[model samples]
Each structure stands twice: as structure tokens, then as C-alpha cells.
Target chain A: MQWLTIYKKECLESARNYKWVWVPLVFILFCIMDPLTTYYLPQILESTGGLPDGATFDIPTPPAANVFMMSISQINTLGVLVIALITMGTIAGERKSGVAELILVKPVSYTAYVTAKWAAHVTLVLLSIFVGLIASWYYVQLLFGDVSFIHALSTAGFYGLYIIFVISISLFMNTWTKTPGLVLFLTISIIMILNLVTSVFSHLLEWSPTNITSYLPSLLRTGEVGQDLWLASLFTIVTIVLLLFGAIQTLKRKEIV
Target chain B: MIQLKNLTKTFDKQYAVKNITFNLPSGKCVALLGPNGAGKTTTLKMIAGLMHPTSGQVELANGVKGDIRKYIGYLPQHPQFHSWMTGMEFLHYVARLSHIPKHESQKLAEQLLDRVGIADAKNRKISKYSGGMKQRLGIAQAMIHKPSVLLLDEPVSALDPIGRRDVLNLMEELKQETTLLYSTHILGDAEEASDEILLMHKGAIVESGSLQDVKERHQVDKITLRFDGNMKAYKEKMEEFPFVTHTDIQKQKIHVYVQNVPEARDVLLELVSKEQWPLLFFEVGQTTLEDLFMKVVNEHAMADHL
Candidate 1:
């Protein structure tokens, strides 16, 4: 009941601050732009640039699945930035402003406090991802070709797992530090470094959470679930749980001034 | 009832709150009196379960120990609320966190708003409220759960005079319903509101007792005499008397600390009449709480140097 109460407050906070509206809108913008730009590149280039007299450009439209992958790449960069901006102040701001001191003095447990924040963030992340993916799916069908609903769902679901992992890491970092700017920097840098390492050494880190992003486009195209995909999903889920646990412990030991 | 047994907190190898022990009786108002950085906030934080003690423990009624935050309500030195939330909504959120049922939390929030005299501004965002209104709201939120023990840290320190009066009056009313422990550096506020006082210095309690008892124990009998002209000879003659234990002279006035006020009064009156001393004013008085506080603190400082 305590966690539910805190979770509801978090939900109301996000809604009132228009985070629910703006975050999803940003995601949808990225989603729509990803495919539209890919489809209209030649026309855009011709309108913007004066070509030489005999220059003729030929550009082919990519496959529907490839457009979805382009959207994933857009989210991998801009979407993560948006998420970081949205959640950078979740715990650290509360602590700095002394709100955390008031709430922590109540009868609530540390686990409930951390979990409630995680749940609220997960809700926002999932809603934003779902809205963006559905919009991307609709445009991919119109601009490219007919894309299977099941494949699109699988792609979104796989990508959603990676987003959740990033959010969990952010929350963990927030609990560990008092500076919101530092937390945001550390979380983004850590995730970026991990993704780079896993991608550069994919042969050695096949089961890393970053592999979820790499497998998402393939899963959308072929509609096949691989053993490594399953292993990566498991690893992501375990890492999320472990990060949340670590956050709770860190908060428990934190000296709230 | 709550008992702090040798509670200590250290930060970066420095003791914020040293090993301190005290018991708070139920339904009584106790004031934690100390200067700034004297560990009052640290002690309250440890009791509120916001910070774990480096050593020792806080034992509640029935000897139940470990996270007794449920039985305690705490307001920090500067209580911060979600500025975007209406006063009523914030109280409702606090009630829920206090484990009140959802259906009843709304009613409790409304009742507490009225109780703390913030009902008129209950619908206003906290950002729009004045300093006093916000403090009243803080008290409303802290009382929403009806905890047995209430702890407030410098609740009136940041307020204007009117705000301080309003909070102190509200505290007076609340002290009757629950055990209250408030920390403050203002001796007048503590003297006006608390029945018992725990005077802390350098992270340790230098004095603790009922207000009347502590005042009585440290009270010194004294007399003051002011002259219209220079009274150097008169002051020297008065200092030779056996009854006058100490004398402080400022300009033409002499403040004489005495062993027996009646005996000193008689001796001083006879001397002033015989020598035709220029006695412009005279009065006898006992030491006030302020004087006792200064004396105790000065003695401790001197002893520390030794």
C-alpha cells in the first residue's frame, strides 16, 4: 500500500509536469521522422541543393523492416537523451530540495521507495515506447511496404527491454550520488560505453543486454527468436533486478541531510 | 515513549552526534536546546530513522527497536514540499505514506488542514503560500497520521515574528495531544513551550532536567545598584563585605552577586546611608534562564580549556 501510494504520487507528478505529454511527443517525432526522411531523401536533396547540369541521382526505398531499424537507431541516440533528461532529477532533485527528507521520515521502507520510483519510470518509458512504435509502424506501412504487426510488436518489445535496463541503471546511479548532473552523466556514459563494448566485441559478449538492440531489427525481419536473444533478455531482466536491489541498499545507507 | 541509548553518528570521521542518551516521556513537551551545529539536527535525524546511528540505538515503547519511524513524526529544520502540489493534496499523499486507508486519507487531510489553520489555502499550490502558511502545512502533514511522538527541528527559526507566534501557538495546542520534542536555539521559544529542557553543547548534553528544576539549580541571588555619579569608593567598600561573593561594575552601576540576598540588602542599604553614596537606583533579582545558560556554557568552555 505504501509503494502504491508513492507510485501514484509519482504518476501524478509526471502527469502534472506534462512529462507524459512531452516525452511521448518527442519519441513520436523521432519515430515519424526516421522513416519519412529515409523515404524522401532524394527529393529533399534535389530541393535543397543545386545539382550540376547532367547529375541524375537514383535512390531506392529501404524495406519496411530496415525503416524500423532506422527508427531504433534514432531512439538509441535521441530517445536515450530524452529519457535521461526526463529522469535526471527523479531522486537527486528530491534529496537536494529536502523533499526526500520529509518522505523518508515516514513509515515507508527503503525498498518501497526505490521500487515506486522505478515503477513510475517504467510506466512512462513503456507508454512512450509503445506510442512511438505504433506510430512508426503505421508510417512504415504507408511509406515503405506492408509490415507484419507481429514482427513490429517483437521489435518494440525487444527494444523496450533495453530501455528498461537503461532506466534501471539511471535509478541506481541516482541513488548512489547526490548530484543530478553527475548521475545523468554517469548513467549515460556507462550505458554508452557498455553498448560500445558489447557491439565491438559481440563475439565475446553475445549474452549482454546491449545485444537486444542488435537483435531487434533481425527479429522484426525474420520473426525468429534466437537462443542468444533469449539469453540477452534473461540477462537484462536479471541486471534490472540487481540494479534496483542495489539502489534500495544505497538509499538505505544514504545520509540524508 | 522513546529512548535514545548512547546514539552516535559520524560523518567523514567526525562526530556529528556523539554518544548521547535521553528518554522522552509520552504526552510531554521536551525541548532540545542547543546552538547551531551543536548536534540537535543530527540527533533528531537519527531518531526519525533518516540516518542510521554509527553506534547505539533508539528504543521505543515496549522495547521495540529497529525502524520505529511508524510511531514517530518528524519535520526537518526546513520542511520541503512538492511546490506544484496543493496543500491539501500534499497532506493526502503524506497520510497515505503514513499507512492510512485511501478512503480516509482525504478526510484526514482536510481535517488536518483546518486544524493547523491552513484550510483557507488548502487548494493553493505550495509555491503560492507564504512562509508561515507553508510551516502550518508542514505541521498539518506531520500530524496527519497522529503519531505518538512528534519531532520538529527548528520549526520556528525561519519564520517571521507573526509566523513564529502562529507556529508556537500551534505547537502549544499539539503538545497536549502527543509527546513533542522540538530542537531550537532560541531559549525564549523553548522556555515558553517546553516543560523539560535538554541543553546540548558540542554534541553532548551539558544539562537536562525539568524547566523549573534546572532554573532553580543554577539561579544566583543578586542585587543591582546604580549611582548618579562615580561610585568607585562605594564599589570597593561593598566588595569587602562577606555577603557579596562577586561584583561586576559598569560605569556608575554595580551588579553584586551575593550569598544571602536579604543580608546583602541590609548591609548595602546601611553602607549607602552612612556614606551618603549617590544611589540612583537599586533592585534585587534572581538569575534568569538566559543567565544560567551563559554561566553553564562559560563554565564548560573553561573546563574544556583546562
Candidate 2:
């Protein structure tokens, strides 16, 4: 119940800051541009080329599933950056500004405080991603052809798990650092390193959470779910839970002075 | 009532509050008086459950030992609020955190805002509030839970004269309804507002008692006299008197500490009459808390040097 109150406050704060509105706007904008750019590339090449007398250009219309995959890739980079920017100050800012002392001095539990922040961030991430994916699907249908709604939704669900994983890592980093800049730097670095290491050593690290990002595009393109995808999804969910638990412990022992 | 038994807090292997023990009787306002770095804030934070004591315990009136924060209201020396939140919103948030019923929390927040005299500005964001207004809002939130004991750390030390008076007046009114304990370096404010004084120096309670009792214990027989004639000659002559133990002369006034006021008064009057020295004013009384606080703090400094 107390968590609910705190969660509402977080949501209200995001609304007041216009993060809830603008973040999804950015996402939807990126999603729409992906399909529109793919559709117009041949015309753009011809207009800008001024090709020599015998030069020839051949461009093919890509599949709608491929357009959806292209949109996911765009979201994988920009969406993660947006999520990091939004949540970097969730915990550390409160501690730095002395607001934590006031709230913690009450009868409320530390678990509730951390969980409320996690839930709020998850809500925003999921909402923005859902809207962006649906918009991307609509644009793909209009510009290219029809893509299966179930496949797109399933891909988004799997992909949303990876975004939640990033958000939890952000919450954990915030608990460990007092500076929001440091939290952003550390969270991005950790995710990038994890993704790079798992991709390089894919034979050994197939079940890593980073695999979820790779599997997202393939799942949307191929319309097939592999055993590796199932394992990676399970690993991503477990990692998020563990990160939240770690965040709670770190915050419980945090010194507000 | 609140009891602190051997409550101590250590920072970096050094004692901030060391084996301190005291009792605050129910419905009485107590002032924790000390100089800066005297561990007054540390002690209050410990009781407020904001900091854990190194080796002791704070037991409430019912003898409940742990997690008594719900029953105590605390205001830090410099309170911080979410600048984006309006005063009413912040209070409602705090009241809800204390688990007040949803319907009652709104009414309680309004009552508290009015009580703190900030109801008119309750709709304005806290960032727009002045320092004094923020302090008043701090007080209102601290009292929102209606806790049994209110712990304020240097509540009025940072305010201007008018702001200080407003907070002090609010505290005076609050002590009538709850057990209020506040720490301050201002001896005059403590004397004016508190029923009891706990004088702390170097992480220890050097003196603790009711205002009257502490004064009586440290009181000395002293008389202050101001003259209209040559002050130097009068000071020298008065210093020569046998009953006069010590004399501090400044300009036209001389403060004479005596062994017995009656004997010193008779002798001084006779000397003044015989010499026909012009006199303007005279007063005799015990030492004020200001004097006592300075005496205690200075003695501690001297003892440290020794």
C-alpha cells in the first residue's frame, strides 16, 4: 500500500517533468522514420547520386518483417539511451538532495521505496515501447506490407524484458553512486560491455541477457522462437529480479550523511 | 516520556555522543544546549531513529526498544523538500506515509498548514517559499504524524531574528501539546522557551536539570552597579573591599561578585554615602544561563588544554 503511494508520486513527477509524454514521442518518431527511410532510399539515392554515364543502381523493397526488425534495432540504441536519461536520478538524486532522510525517517520500509522506483520506471519503459512498436507496425503496414501483430507483440514483449533489465541495472547503479552522471556512465558502460562480451563469446555466453536483444530482431524477422531465446528470456527475467534485490540491499545500508 | 540509556554514537572511531543518559518527562519542553560540535545534533538524531547508536538504546515511554520512528517526529537542522511539490502535496504525501486514512489525510494536511500559518501559500511550489516559510513547512510535516515526542535539531539556528521568533513561538505553542526536545546553540532562546536544559560539551552531558535547578546549582552572588562619577577610582576602591570576591569593570559599570550580598551591600552603601559618590543604577541577582553556558563551555576547553 505504501509502495502504491510512492509509485503514484513517481508517476506524477514524471508527468510534471513531461518525461512520460516526450520520451514516447521520441520513440514513436524514431519508429516512424525507420520504415519511411527504408521506403524512400531508392528515390533518395537517384536524386543525390548524379551518376556517371554508365552507372547503374539497383535497390530492392525489403520485407515488412525486415522493416520491423530494423525498427527494433533503432529502438535498441535510442530507447536504451532515453531510459537511462529518465531514470539516472531516481534514487541517487533523492539521497544527494537530502530528501531520502525525510522519507526514510518515516515508518515506511526501504523495500517499498526501491520497489516503487523500479515499478515506476518499468511502467514508463513498457508504455513508451508499446506505443512505439505499435506505431512502427502501423507504418510498416502502410509503407511496405502487412506484418503479423502477434509476432510484433511477442517480439516487443521479449524486447521489453531487455529494457527492464537495463532499467534495473540503472536502479542498482543509482544506489551505488551519489552522482547521476556517474550512474548514467556506469549503467551504459555495463550494458555495452555485457553486450559486446556476450556477442564475442557467443559460444560460451549464449544464455546471457544480452542475447535477448539479438533474439528480438530475429524473432520479429523469422517468426520463430529458438531454444536459445527461451533460455535468454528466462535469464533476463532472473537478472532483473536479482538486480532489484541487490538495489534494495544496497539502499538499506546506504548512509544518508 | 522518553528515556535514553547510555546512548552513544561514534563516527570514524571517535565519539560524537558518549555514554549519554537523560530522561524527558512527558509534556515538558527540553532544550539540548551546547556549542557547535557538542554532539547535540547526534544525540537528537539517535533518538529520532535517523541514526543508529553505537552502543546504547533509546526506549520510548512504553519501553518499546526498536523502530520507534513512527511515534516520533523529527525536523533536521536544515530540512529539504521536493522543490516541485506544493506544500499541501508534500504534507499529504507525508501524512499518507504515516498511514493516515486517505480521507483524513487531506483534512489533516490542511489543519497542519493552517496551524503553521502557511495555508495561504500551500498551493505554491516549495521552491518559491522563503527560508522562514520552508522552516515552517518543515515543522508542519514533522508534526503531521502527531507523534508523542518531537525531535528538532537546531530548529531556529539558521533563521533571521523575525524568522527565529516565529519558529520559537511555534515551538512554544507545540510544547504545550507534545513532548518537544530541540537542540540549539542559542542560550537565550533556550532560556526563553525550554522547561529543562541539557548542557552538552565534548560528547557528554555536563549539566541537566530544570531551568531553575540548573541556575540555582550554578548561581553566584553578584551585584552590578553603574556610577555617574569617575569610574576608575570607584572600581579601585570597590575592589579593595574585603567582602568583594571579584570585580569586572567596564566603562561606567562594575560587576562585583561578593561572598555575602547583605554585608557587601551595607559596606558599599556606607562607602558611597561617606564619599558622596554619585551613583546611577545598581542590581543584584544570580547568574543568567548565558553566563552558566559560557562558564561550562570554557571550563571544558580549559580542562581539555590541561
Worst 10 residues of 2 chain A by lDDT: A49-58
Give residue B236's lDDT in candidate 2 (0 to 100). 85
Q: Candidate 1, residues A133-197: lDDT per residue as tens digits?
A: 89999999998998899989988988899999989989998898878998889989998899899
**Model 1 over residues B1-306: C-alpha lDDT tens digits?**
998999988889988888899999888999999878889999998888888899999999777767788888888887899999999899989899988998899998988888888899999999999878888888887788888999999999989998899899989999889999999999999999999999998788889999999998988998989987676767788899988877777556787889998888998899889988778999999878887776667777888899
Q: lDDT of model 1 at residue B128?
A: 98
Q: What is candidate 1's fraction of native contacts?
A: 0.89
Instruction: List TM-score (chain A only) for every prediction.
Output: 0.97, 0.95
Q: What overall lDDT, based on C-alpha atoms, would model 1 receive against the true structure?
A: 0.88
lDDT of 1 at A246: 94
* TM-score of candidate 1's A chain against the true A chain: 0.97
Reproduced native contacts, each prediction: 0.89, 0.56
Highest TM-score against the true fold, candidate: 1
Q: Write the per-residue lDDT of candidate 2 for residues B1-306, one digit (tens) a residue.
A: 899999988999998999998888999999999999999988988887777789888998787777798989989888899889999999999999999988899999999999888999999999999988988899999999999999998889889998898889999999889999999999888998999999999999999999999999988888888888668778889998788877767556788888899988888888888998888888887677887887789889989899
Pairing residues by index, what is the TM-score of model 1?
Answer: 0.94
Candidate 2 is graded, for docking, as medium
